[model samples]
Target: MTLDPSVVTAFTPTGKLRASINLGNPVLAKRDPVSGEPCGVSVDLARAFAERLSVDLELVAFDTAGKSVEAVSDERADIGFFAVDPLRAQAISFTAPYVLIEGFYLVRDDSPITRNQDVDQPHNRVAVGKGSAYDLFLTREIKTAQIVRAPTSPAVVQTFIEQNLEVAAGVKQQLESDASRFSGLRLLDERFMVIQQAMGTPKSRGLAAATALQRFVEAMKTSGFVSAALERHGIAGASVAPAA
Candidate 1:
């Protein structure tokens, strides 16, 4: 796709496209075991978008989604991959989602909470990664449950254990991995939410730039690029979003 020069400039005012990548979300990105560099589905998309803009790609890496979102919101980075949330959309214009992932709740196997709706008891304290999609979503949706925040998503389970919280909320894949590392923990039979993961640029970038990004995302989804990336990266519990 040939974008207008203005649109390209909007995405790459620094001559290189800076894409904020969050390594905190294992399903989206992670440190390569051998090379110790960032690699995963988000990295692939960032590189591809930079190429579409015909600019050098500068990956600005963060260990948390909040930090990554802040980078793009502050215009420190030109673009980023993020979960579509109403709060984040205030400063970032997101495309239709390119991937869909589920949010789940985890608890000790002996715990009485066996269903997603059982988590909102007045006495149950839930652990969540501060400023994550889960945190933001649950903050609004969960009325009775108290939320305790961990420093980052990867630390949510540890925080839950350390604080003796009743529940840990996070990505299904992440919580499952934590369950394996520990004992006597199980996920609820159903997911609490479906996360729409999409590309975003600062709303300051203008409508034309946002439209270009939206088009890019839809094209990638329809072309099977997203599905291919998930398979290549061995990412389960996430799937390509339908074209918008």
Candidate 2:
């Protein structure tokens, strides 16, 4: 497939494709324990996009999704991987999602919050990763529960424990992992929301960049590249999103 030079330039203004890698979102990206290098479906997708553009790939690592979004909004990153969120759309032009993951509530095993629907209560204090899709969604959806923001997604569980929060909201996989690591924690069976993981470019990059990104994502999905990437990375709890 021939890429338009203008689109390529817009995605790589500095002549290298700088992708903001958010390690906090385990479904998208993770740190390799042995090498400390970033890996996972998002990393694979970024590498594929850089290869398609025939540009050198530069991974701008950020520990949190909020920082990753800021990096792209500030134009420090040519492109970024993020959960498609309306609140973040003000600064980013997100393509159709390439992967879909679930959001859930984590609570103490003996806590009264027995279901996802029970999370929003008058006295409930919900802990969430600052600026994440969960935080943004819950901010708009929860009318009663007070939200306490943690510094990052991976820190949400610990923050909940440390603060004695009634409920913790985050990626389902991360919460599940936390449940296994920490005793007395359990994830609600029902999902609170579905996270649409997508690639984003700065809004200032214009329509061409957005169109190119959307096409790239759809092609990756239809061509089985996304499925292959997930399999290759051994990532679970996420599926290739339907073509948009």
Candidate 3:
């Protein structure tokens, strides 16, 4: 796909396509165990987008979603992979999601939080990754429970365990992995929310560039690129989003 010159310029103002990668989201990105380089579905998408624009790819890596979103909003990076939230949309133009991931709640096996609804009690302190999708969502939806934030998404379970919090909130796959490492932890049977993971550019990039990105995401979803990347990276518990 040939992108317009203006669109290319918008995404490559620094002469390279800088993609803000959040290594905290294991499903979308992670450090290679051996190489320690960022690799996963989001990395593949960033590379493909850079190639489409015919620019060199520069990964601006961050350990948290908040930092990644900040990079794009501040124009330190041209694009980023992020969970779509209304608060984030104020500064970034997001495409329709390319992947859908479930947000689940975790608790000790002996904990009384048997259902998703049981999590909102006033006495329950829920641990979540600060500035993560779960954090953003729960900050609004959780009426009575108090939210305690960990440094990053991967730290939520640890924070919950350490602080004796009543619940932990995060990605289903991530929570499952964490549960396996510790004893007596279990996930609630039902998910609390579905996170829409999408690609975004700074709204300052203009309507044309934003529209081009939206089209690119739709094409990626329709052509099996997103699905293939998920499988190639051995990502489970997440699915390719339907075409927008």
Candidate 4:
């Protein structure tokens, strides 16, 4: 069967950021529980991208971020619309970040590991998604925590809620949300790895498309359009750092 046109554009109905956004995080994807339609910050941003492109908006949904990246790699989607890291950059070309985010550590609010440094102490069993940025950051930068890979944030929460683990790391936004679900848990100190949230295109796609998207995203940044989109979705604080 012919590839759906959305596949060619990385799930964007139009081949531009303004026309669409697709994501792997369903919590953020904002699905209509009844119609199962895609909705959320990612979808809204994609719509903004389409509007900037002067095209119609469309969003394709994926259940997980990893699968969203796979869609881009396999030409089924245009972008994953989430945090970008070095490994992902190697796998897919990315535009300059439109939002700056930080990774975080979460634990029971009453846990003794109150500071970021405490997590590094011996036998501190920290849970994190197997292939997630939290895993990468903790394994590489956070030398103190003994990592117990959980494969997904919810899974980590499951174990933590059962008192099976002490500390865990994940995206601050996701972790904070999970913390709300469990009364005992809360996000710890602001220890976070500053990351730029960017869009992706297949690596095989030449520099032209990637560069063009980057430039367009930058222009949107300067024009304050991106900020408007973020506020529209209640993500007011997600943006690039102001000039030094």
**Best candidate according to lDDT:** 3
lDDT of candidate model 3 versus the reference: 0.95
- C-alpha RMSD of each candidate structure in angstroms: 0.7, 1.1, 0.6, 5.3
**Better model by TM-score: candidate 2 vs candidate 3:** 3
- The candidate 2 region of ten consecutive residues with least summed lDDT is 178-187
Q: lDDT score, residue 33, model 3?
A: 98
Better of 1 and 2 by TM-score: 1
Clashing pairs in 2: none
In order, candidate lDDTs are 0.94, 0.90, 0.95, 0.64
Sort order, lDDT high to low = 3, 1, 2, 4
What value of lDDT does candidate 4 attain over all alpha carbons?
A: 0.64
Off by over 4 Å in 4: 1-28, 50-58, 240-244
lDDT of 2 by residue, 99-165 (tens): 9999989889899889877878889999999989889899999998899999999989899999999
Global local distance difference test of model 1? 0.94
Candidate 1, 46-141: lDDT as tens digits: 999988998899999999999999999999999999999999999999999999999999999899999988999999999998889999999999
Q: Which stretches of candidate 3 lie over 4 Å from their true place?
A: none
Error in Å for residue 12 of model 4:
9.0
Model 1 spans > 4 angstroms off:
none
Which residue pairs in candidate 3 collide? none
Task: Report model 3's TM-score to 2 decimal places.
Answer: 0.99
